[model samples]
Target: MDVCLLYFEDCPNWKVTDRRLVAIAAEHPEVVVRRKRVETMEQAERVGFRGSPTVLVDGADLFASPDSAAGFSCRVYRTADGLEGAPTLEQLRVALGLTQEVTR
Candidate 1:
């Protein structure tokens, strides 16, 4: 599975999402994780970034939402706790269908 973390500068949650992806990637080495930065509004539009720190699984947004007009903004994520800047690791695991068990 290919995963890409599309983000922009000044997005604080991007780092946390990056860390979570790193750990998740360890479990699925075959999954390639790429970081795409949206540097401008045009870039954001051309790339169809839902918001900063948009996680794309196999070229599709993990979170299913009606595509917005497309702009540079801070996107809020839906988490177990509530709306958040990023989803929990477990949420990501389920979304990606990755196992939490560590192979010995």
Candidate 2:
């Protein structure tokens, strides 16, 4: 699977997301995560970048939002705990279909 991590340099949350993505990718051999730096507003708009640390699986946003406007900004995630800078590890695993059902 082609996973792209879109983000701006100024966004601090991207680093956190990147680390998690790396760890997840290590577990899934088919997953490949790429970093995309959105430097300009026009580039952001053209690439459909909702905000920094936007996780795109197969060129589509994993957690797509209809109301979100494409631009260079910090992205927030609604995790189980609360609003977070990045998605939780479990969230990533679930989104990427890495979670396997235990049959015991």
Candidate 3:
């Protein structure tokens, strides 16, 4: 699976998502994590970037919503704990079609 993490430079939450991806990649060798920097609004629009830290799996948005629009901004995720800067590790696992497991 190819997981692409799209984000801008200023967003603080991208790193959080990156860490989770790294953890997932460690456990699942088949998973490939790549980062794409969306530097400008034009670039964001060109790639259909919903927001910073937008996680795309196999070229599709993993957390896409009808209301979400493409732009250069921070993305919020609705996790089990409520709205968060990024999705939890377990969430990523499930999104990637992996069994739920405790992440270190």
What TM-score against the true fold does each predicted structure earn? Answer: 0.86, 0.91, 0.91
Q: Residue-wise lDDT of candidate 2 within 60-100, one digit each (tens)?
A: 88786888989877899988788998988888877887885
Task: Report, for all candidates in order, the number of backbone clashes.
Answer: 0, 0, 0
Question: On a 0 to 100 scale, what is the lDDT of residue 4 in model 1?
Answer: 89
Q: Write the per-residue lDDT of candidate 1 for residues 1-104, one digit (tens) a residue.
A: 88888898898988888999999888889777899999888887777798878888987786758856677777887776778888778878877878563222
Candidate 2 ranges with C-alpha deviation above 4 Å: 100-104
Better of 1 and 3 by TM-score: 3
Evaluated against the true structure, the overall lDDT of model 1 is 0.81
Cα lDDT tens digits, model 3, 1-104, are 99999999899999999999999999999999999999888888787799889999999897889878898778988887789989888889888989765344
Better of 1 and 2 by lDDT: 2
| Residue-level lDDT for 72 in candidate 1 | 74
Clashing pairs in 1: none
User: Which residue pairs does candidate 2 place in steric collision?
Assistant: none
- Sorted on lDDT, best first, the list reads 3, 2, 1
Best by lDDT: 3
Give the TM-score comparing model 2 with the true structure, all chains together: 0.91
